[model samples]
Target: MYVYDEFDRAFLAERVAEFRDQVARRLSGALSEDEFKPLRLMNGVYLQLHAYMLRVAIPYGTLSSDQLRRLAYVARTYDRGYGHFTTRQNIQFNWIKLEDLPDAMAALAEVGVHGIQTSGNCIRNVTTDQWAGATPQEFDDPRIWAEILRQYSTLHPEFTYLPRKFKIAITAAPKDRAATKVHDVGLRLHRNEAGELGFEVLVGGGLGRTPFVGKSVRAFLPARHLLSYIEAIMRVYNQYGRRDNIYKARIKILVHEIGAEAFAKAVEAEWEAIRDGALHLSDEIIADIRSRFLYPDFQPRADQPAALATALEDPAFAAWHRNSVHPHKVPGHAIVTVSLKAIGAPPGDATADQMEVVAALADDFGWREIRVGHEQNLCLPNVAQEDLPAIWRRLEAAGLATPNVNHISDIIACPGLDYCALANARAIPVAQEIAKRFADLERSRTIGRLHVNISGCINACGHHHVGHIGILGVEKNGQEFYQITLGGRADEHAQLGTLLGPAVSYEQVPGLIEDVVDTYIELRAGPDELFIDTVARLGVEPFKERVYAAH
Candidate 1:
């Protein structure tokens, strides 16, 4: 975790005070709703269908226990008893009172947290792999660069008001857990033949009404030139990105229109102009940034404890271990994903009580640290293998241990028509119903790694374009209907899903999903074949035929 310095504290204080005054003005009628819109958005506040929503940034998805406790306090005191963790690894409070906005910001500031850049037509939160530091396969920690970007872009005058919201994601691992392909700018940290670290930069990737998998603009950019090259990309976007229509404003549109080759050429010219400029990161600066991040002290343990092996005898424990547990870089350690998507519950939501329980878990079993994953789950990144049973018991009791990571029920759904004014259909009920349809734990496991992402609209907030089974809510003849897509994935081999058939009524969704899964089961080579693998082997035609045949 990166601790806030004195400068960070002062900046947050100033920003909070500024927003406080703005909020007061709006409440006092000095500022009208239209006048307050951008101001509120800049501060991460949104006026949703029912109430004000506040999105707080969890940069790179890392949180100390104290920070987690502060978030829990805010959820308990300011809004509803729970908050929604988003696909981008940030958290949202859907029922924030307008007047309490400043107070909430001030409270969050006390723990080096804020809602800055969470919304608006600016560079949003810089996200990275949730398993950044702990994952074994990573070449280096991507959080270091994410933090560097955070500092550089926080209030960068040049990019403060881009044509549209800009997102950048980085991953050090070979596995694209960060969904780099779907970001405005995706940086993959890897080495060239010489074994020197650098980034494989991708641009023009995004999802909305129009979706694009980012194209590689640079095969190998030296790590030291990261900032300059990124600035070059930003400069290109700011210079030529559309400003006439919001729909065509994103960099992806520009990249698509101009073509990746021309975009790369323009970016290259800009990079040549500033590659050695002030933005160039030096070795000392990189080291300084690295020092700011906290790393856990690990004791040398060559093997897992005997208790862990014994605990595997319990069927429930064994199931959880198989599903929730992941490999860690440290010996005798594991990364445990606490599934927020319990069957029949809204995905990514955690009650204040559950938040506190997770905080306690971080303190007791984990290294007093927690990570918010892109999959809308909480991660204990530094848990000892010996303590898995104890952690599992606690999580199970808290209703946090569903053992459904990467499974059908571990859905990613947005706050659709239920909360968003922009939504066309209700996503929560459909997601809930679908989860209920597959409530059997063993059945879900047998079904295997199926990512069902749902969005209320075409904004793609739930990342529906990249789910194994994507359900997008649409309005037809003034009725809620869903358009389904199959075979989409957000991993290293990221690809947009193919549309199955015509939009189906909300009542047909759960059954449609069930039919698709059944079709996969019937067609798959074996139980070990993943849903994605099966979809790749045989395209969406098979699943589409089965789903629409019944519908």
Candidate 2:
């Protein structure tokens, strides 16, 4: 968890005050929507279809108990009774009133959270591997560097009003849980042959209208010069990143226009000019940041074979183990996912009550910390196997014990045209509808591993372009339409999804998905065949024949 400094706290408070006045002016008719639009967006407030949508930043996707509770409070008091968690790990309250936004920001500030820099064409929140410290494969905790850079990039004067929004993702782990390749700037931490740690920097990687995996610019950037090195890249981007055309502004476009090697040379020249300056990390700062993120002590113990078998036999615990738990680095301890998806419930929606329960559970069970995943789930990273039964009951009561993690119905979705002005269709209801369609536990489990990513629009906030069954919503004569894609994966083996055929009517989606999944079941080589693998082997022809042949 990133601790807020005095400057950080004061800065949030001041920003809140400024936004409060702006909101007041808008209400008093001194400012019109035209005048207040940019100001509201700067504070992560956007006017949506039916109401105001507030996007709160969960930096590096880490949250404290206090912050979670405050988020819950905001959900209950200012907006609806629940908040929607996004694939990017940020939470959005769908029905906020603009007048209450400043008060909301003030409440978030009290807990060291804010919505600043979450929207608009600026450096957005830095997202990392959800299993940052806990995952075994990680070489170094990327959250440490994410926090360091979060502070450095917050409201940077030089690049706040760029041509379009900017995003950066970092991962120390080799498994690529952060989806590093699909970011504006992707950083992978590795050690050179000489045992010196540095980053393999990739620039100009993003997914939107144009999807391009980031390419390597600097193969090795030493650890100590992280901030300076990143500064150099940003300086290069700030100078050359297109400001003329909104569609062609991201660094990926620049990289494509001039090529990766050319971009690398420019960044190197920029690094030579301003490195080792005020932006560079000092030894003390690095130590301070690193200490804050140090892993908690773990007790070495072997699992009791007899007792373990007994627990796994229990129905509730069996479901949880099957769905929500992962093997911990420590023996006998398991990383538990408190599923935010309940049948008929919104995919990542959690009530304030649920938030408090999760927070208390983190302190009591997970060593006082919680992690928000890119898939919109929360993980308690240090639960002993023994404590899982009690957790299941508590989570069951809180309505967060849904036993779907990466299963067929554990879908990722965006706040579509329902709550986002930029969106073209309604995504939340579709996700909810799909969950309801496959509400049967045995059916979803039988279908096996499937990733269904939904985006309300082509803006691609939902990452629909990269789902095993990707669905993009389009406007057809003013009615909602959806296009499906097969074979997308967001992993070390990252591959973009391919379009199946023409757009399907919105009403035809759930049945279409069911047909595709049913086809996978009928045509599978065995139960071991995943949805993506089946698509890869047989190609889209099989699924497409089943889908569009009837249409």
Candidate 3:
């Protein structure tokens, strides 16, 4: 984790003080709601349908146990007894009082966390593979560049207010766990033929009303010229991106309007003038940033064959071991995902007590570190294999051990009309209904490796565009309805899903989904064939026919 230096501390203190003053003025009637909107947004505060919502950034989704405890404290003291982890790997408190926001910001600052740049048209939190440092297949820790980009983008005067909000994601692994194809700017770190490290830069990828997979603008951008190249891209977008229409304001829209080749040429022309300027990163600075991310001392341990034997005996443990535990680079260790998608609960939400329990478990068994995945699950990245049973027991007792990672029950849903002002229908209840519909562990296992994402609206905050089964909520004739899509994926071979059929009523959503799953099962060649592979093989026509016919 990157520790805050004196400059970092001082900068955050100044931001807090400024926001405090702004809030005081608003309360004193010196500022109207309209006048204070941008100010509150800049600080990651939003007035939602019911109450104020505060989003706190968790850079690269890394947190210390102490930091986790601090978040729990905030949930317990300031708002409701729970917080929602978002698809962006950030957390949102949905019930904050307007007057207590500054105090909340101060509390977060005490633990080296902040909500800066979490909202309002600038680059948001730079995310990477949650298993960055621990994964064996990665070329290097992607967080190295994520941190560098965060530092460079934070409060950059030229980019403080863009035509629209921008997002950047980085990954060094062969797998696209970071969903690189769906970001405003996606950087894939790779080695060239000469064995020199560089980046494969992609631009224009985004999901909203108009979804697009980013195009590769540069086959290879030198590692040293990252900042310069990014600046060039920003300059191009800032100058020509749509400003009159909010829907087309994103860089993705600009890239789509202009050809990718022309966009690439424009960026290259801008880069040529500034590639060797002060923005170029030096080798020394890169090394210094790399040094700050020291890995924990992993002691050699023998594999626990007894735990494997126990898995054979207990079907519950076996299911958990298969789904929750991931392979680790270190011997006799594993990465455990604490599923927030327990049956009938809102996806990605954790109570204050649950947060405290996770913190304690991390301190005791996970080297005092915790990670949040873009899937909205908590990860103990370095748990020893021998300790799996005890950890599973503890998590199960706390209702955190659902063992449904990448399965039908592990849904990803947004706050929707339940909390978000931009939403058309309630998303959380839809997700909860679906989870409850597939509550049988054996049934979910049979369904196998499915991602069901629901977004309340076209904002795509829930990333519905990329799920294997994407459910989008819309309003028709003053009633809530859902439009379904199939075959979307966010992996190495990313593609946007195609619409399945006409919008169905909220009452028909769960049954429609069940029909889709049943169609996949009937058409699949074998049990090993995933829902996505089946969809790809047979296309959406088969599933669409069954869903609509059943309804």
Candidate 4:
């Protein structure tokens, strides 16, 4: 966690004051709805279908106990008693009143959290692996670089308003937990043949009405020149990215229009001119950034805790451990992922009390650190293995311990017609029905490591394009219909899904998903093969045939 300095505090205060004045003017009729749109968007406020929504940025999904508590307070006081954690690892309060926004902003600023750059065509929250510093297989912590990039790009004069919103993701691990390939700019930190660290940069990756897996622009960008190289890419996009149509404004569209090779050539030419400019990251600056990040203190202990063996005797504890617990860099320490997707509840929402419970657990057992994963989950990145049983019990009591991390029931769904004004249909109820359909833990585990993502429209806020099973809601002839896609995944080998067939009625979606799962089971080599692998091995034909036939 990077603590805010005097300058950071001062900047947040000024922004809050400015926004307060803006809101007052809007209420006083000095600014109309159209006039206040951009100003409110710049402050991360959106006028949704029902009311105003405020999205707060959780940089790289990292938060301290104090910050978490402050978020809990904001949720309790300003809006409803809960907040939705989004796919981009940010939190949104759906019921926020426009008049109370300045108070909320000032309260969040006290803990170094704000919603700036969370909306309007600018660089959004920079995200990375939630387990960045604690994971064993990473080359180095990516959050250090994520924080550096955040400071460099926040309110940058040149990129304040791009043709469209841009996103950047970085990961140091070979296993891409950050969904790097589907971002506007994705960076993977890897060592070259000569053992020098550098980035493998991917440009033009995005999902929306048009989906694309990014193309590799630079096979090796030295770590020292990260900012300069990214600046070059931004310059190229700013210069040529379309502004005429909102649908074609994204950098992904620009890269698609001109070939990727041509885009790379243009970026390289820009890089050649500015690669050694003041934007270059120096050793001292990198070190300073690294030093600001808080790290856990690990103690020597047994590889496997003795109590863990006893805890496994309890089937509930065993299930949670198998699904939610992940390996950590330090021995006798584990990373605990808390699933917010409980049974039929809205995915990624945490009640104010639940937030406090997680914060309390982090303070007591997790070295006072918490992380929000892009999967709509919370993580205690450094929990002692011996304390696993106690943590599980606590989580269970709080309704935060759903042992379906990667299973079928752990769905990713956007706030469709329930919240968003742009949505054509409701997504939350669709996700809820599917979750209820697969509520049996044993049956879900049998289905195995499946991702089900739903979006109300083509905006793709739920990341429906990259799920193993994607559901897109559409309005056809005054009726709600859902389109299904298969075999998409967001990882090192990222690819967009293939549509199975024409859209089906909303009532047919759950049964359709069940038919697809049953088809995978019948066609899979064995229980060892995942749904995604089976879909990859056999194309979408088998599942598509079964699903349509069943329908």
**Candidate 4 lDDT trough over 10 residues, lowest sum:** 294-303
In model 4, what is the error at residue 198, expressed in angstroms? Answer: 1.1
**Candidate 2 or 1, higher TM-score:** 1
**Candidate 2 accuracy as lDDT:** 0.85
- Show model 4 residue runs off by greater than 4 Å: none
> Which lDDT tens digits does candidate 2 get at residues 1-551?
56667888888888999989999999999999999999989988878888888999999988887788889899888987889888778998989887788888899999889999989988999999888777777788889989888878888898787777888999997788888888898889989999988899888877788988789888888888888888887788888888888889888998999999998898888888778777677779889988766466778656644556778888877877788888776777888877787877767888889999999988777777788888888988777777777788788888888888887678888878767788888898898889898888888788887888999988888788778989999998999999999998877677789899998888999989888888889888998888889888999998888877666
After superposing candidate 1 on the true structure, give the runs of residues whose Cα lies further than 4 Å from its correct spot: none
Tens digits of per-residue lDDT for model 4, 1-551: 67678999999999999999999999999999999999999989999999999999999999998999999999999989999999999999999898999999999998888999999999999999999889999999999889989999999999999999999999999999999999999999999999988999999899999999999999999999999999999999999999999999999999999989999999999999999999888899999898887777678978777899999999999999999999988999999999999999999999999999999999999989899999999999999999999999999999999999999989999999999999988899988999999999989988889999999999999999999999999999889998999999998999999999999998999999999999999999999999999999999998877789877
User: What would you estimate as the lDDT of candidate 1?
Assistant: 0.93
Better of 1 and 3 by TM-score: 1
Model 3 clashing residue pairs (backbone): none
Candidate 2: segments with Cα more than 4 A from true spot: 294-297, 300-309
Q: Give per-model TM-scores.
A: 0.99, 0.95, 0.98, 0.99
Q: Model 2: what TM-score?
A: 0.95
Residue 307 miss distance in model 2 (angstroms): 5.7
- What is each predicted model's overall lDDT from 0 to 1? 0.93, 0.85, 0.92, 0.93
lDDT per residue for candidate 1 within 336-370, as digits (tens), equals 99999999899999999999999999999887999
